[model samples]
Target chain A: MMKTKTKIPEYTSPLIEQIYEGISQNTFDFVANRMQLALRISEAIKAKNWSQKQFAEMMGKRPSEVSRWLSGTHNFTTDTLWHIEQVLDIRLLAETNQESTPIFEADRLRKFVLQEVNNALEKYLSSRKLVSA
Target chain B: MKFKIVKLSRFSGNKSSLYSVIIDGEQETLFDTFIRNNVSENLHEVEQIFATLNSIGKKVGANDIFFRKKKEGKAGDGVEAIYDYPSAKLRLYCIRYGSVTLVLGDGGEKKVRAWQDDEQLSKAANEMIKISQILTQAIRDGDLSWDGNDFVGQFEFNDNDEDED
Candidate 1:
């Protein structure tokens, strides 16, 4: 509890507030990715004019779960991120598909295989049309 | 508990005035309690929270994009919990008065799957809810109002009676 009916102190700068100077690169990256991702997701949700409840339904999650995601507390799994990407139509894991330094080998290969299959289908359809003509 | 709101210079800026709650009979504000409890145990998350606060205070002006709206849809301007998104074990709850004013409450580690399962977090969040109600009533009565940076008029409220009733 606080003091009884006392005047609140005038705003005073903290005396010698020690900042987190010399943050390690690893920690920086870790924190940055989490914060940025959370912000991006929240922003996207707001842009689409969906409340957490609506977004949660879209992701097939409980509203509480989506609240945690935006709270920056949810340690989003790759699967959850993928689900979010699908629902929001945003590339949260875009870095994973980078041409250089690909993060997820299996996922990148899956995309590559899908592209190849689509290209083959297109080629076959075009050749059939040419032969018929 | 009755409390007074005070502006914190460390987290304050031209764009926004960050505030903390100091409950009656207590020496520390909720923000102070938050730092005292977690500054040693979870320095990394503490730093991350500080960075977020810095961005909110200095850059973003406590926008909704920076806060997680308490999905409860309960009143108090929809109390929000402070988090850095990508990772956090700690959670600081707050009520954002638009973009320029943020009132911070105490926080602790989320030891369970949901914050409602965590006593400390629930208390902190509940406190914010109460504060939000008080603030909303105050604004409605014109007892308090935001003046860009700091609050003008009566910023203090006694809610012990209401709590008892």
Candidate 2:
């Protein structure tokens, strides 16, 4: 009996490797993760019913450049990130738990109180006018 | 000073009840006065809105005044000035201004229209301006912090076999 040898295909994961390499080179494991971040942003743009052309116009770039970004073919620069944040009108990266837990809670509570006060005032004024007439 | 509400039904849709005031021969848009009077705890919202508007090619002149293009009018002329805070979906427009403010709402149609005669517009505008000032300072001073995602840290996992060698 003769034994047959099987050939295995050689595959290099360029995208995966790029992400790994980018992560390894970072001082604190930040930056260079733009490829993954871009995917999230692209998803958000679609969810918001915004087109690449509109986003490009907002960023003052041509539609082709935006196309490249969405395709993940282009490495994003810091300037581009800033522009994206501006155009999307969202904070892509916020300090992780930077504020004390209590402080954050207090801020939330304050907002609620203010909203209630405004609502009450509005209601009172409306009723007062109705009564006068 | 004595004040009167100039009906703005001609400009905005019938659903919108818009009015302005005339004071001392000067017109102060109600929306503008509201922003000028209100104080905001979170200036971040205001800053973000202004930046978004500015990025979208909205015209902003000195004093942070944003002008919206008139549907049909001559160049450099607009029927309204809109201050939009996109984060809150809150927008205020100045139809006319004098001693009393005549504010209109294009964003929060129902809420803003209901408070056409209230002083809330002035308070909200003031708060918005305060927030804008803080945002401007943050940008100018570079006090804005970048998200942690920008910095990457690495760890090496050494195998026991490699250590034995």
Candidate 3:
């Protein structure tokens, strides 16, 4: 007898496609990128020999919620992302520096070196004066 | 603080390379480098690496040498290697100092290992702490949105409404 085929759940709807594409092209590639990342997280959890229930407890979320996140069907919010970062302890992005680069130009290097030398000389003189007194 | 790229290596059989960056005198961070030879590949591995590093309390920043290239949009100017996987691609930038090593990358699936002296391990650990702090802040701020992508909305069918009608 032939075995019947089980139907796979339709996880990718038109709306999901739109969202995936929109985020992939418009905002950040992280939308679809996150799906794979979530899978990796799941794998990492498994590697640690933790079950979904245990992971949920660790995350302070309901097991069902963890299941949803692992399922890759639920949409994620910024707050959720923040929570994930807090719980996972990872930096998902890089910080931008506000300072301009010209400030570190080699032309100013001499001034900084002279200032440091002067400060060191002042400290040494002060220490010597205190010792003598 | 001044930063340096120290080591670049391939993870598994992928094309992306894992990177380590050394900062100031004591801190080290890991990153997934995404651009190699001026090409962009799958960044999923980089993201995974970031997640893993973040989960462990590593901080990341653009100023970190691991993620910084000599020139942006230039092919092979400073990027050492590129790792490509089915899900994503990654570039690796390694910064080494004394006995410490730092790794950096774009979000991708690549992994990297760096060789450094035992004396540098302490500095590497300190670097990891600083990187972890940066990573934690980035994750908290949702600054990881790199591709400029987002979910627009969700629609659900209302069975109860249909039944009432």
Candidate 2: RMSD over Cα atoms?
A: 28.5
Regarding TM-score, does 1 or 3 come out ahead?
1
In the order shown, the candidates' DockQ scores are 0.10, 0.01, 0.01
Off by over 4 Å in 2: A1-94, A97-123, A130-133, B1-65, B83-165
Q: lDDT of each structure?
A: 0.69, 0.37, 0.37
- Which RMSD values do the candidates have, in order? 16.6, 28.5, 26.9
TM-score of chain A of each: 0.55, 0.43, 0.42
Candidate 1 C-alpha lDDT tens digits along B68-111: 66453264455887644445678788888887988888878877
lDDT of 3 by residue, A27-131 (tens): 133333544455555666776788878978988999867765754334667677677667666544335576667756765887867765765465355434433
Best by TM-score: 1
What docking grade does candidate 3 earn?
incorrect
Please give the range of 10 consecutive residues that has the lowest summed lDDT in model 3 chain B. B148-157
CA displacement after TM-score superposition, residue B83 of candidate 2 (Å): 4.9
Per-candidate TM-score against the hidden true structure: 0.61, 0.25, 0.24
Question: Against the true structure, whose DockQ is highest?
Answer: 1
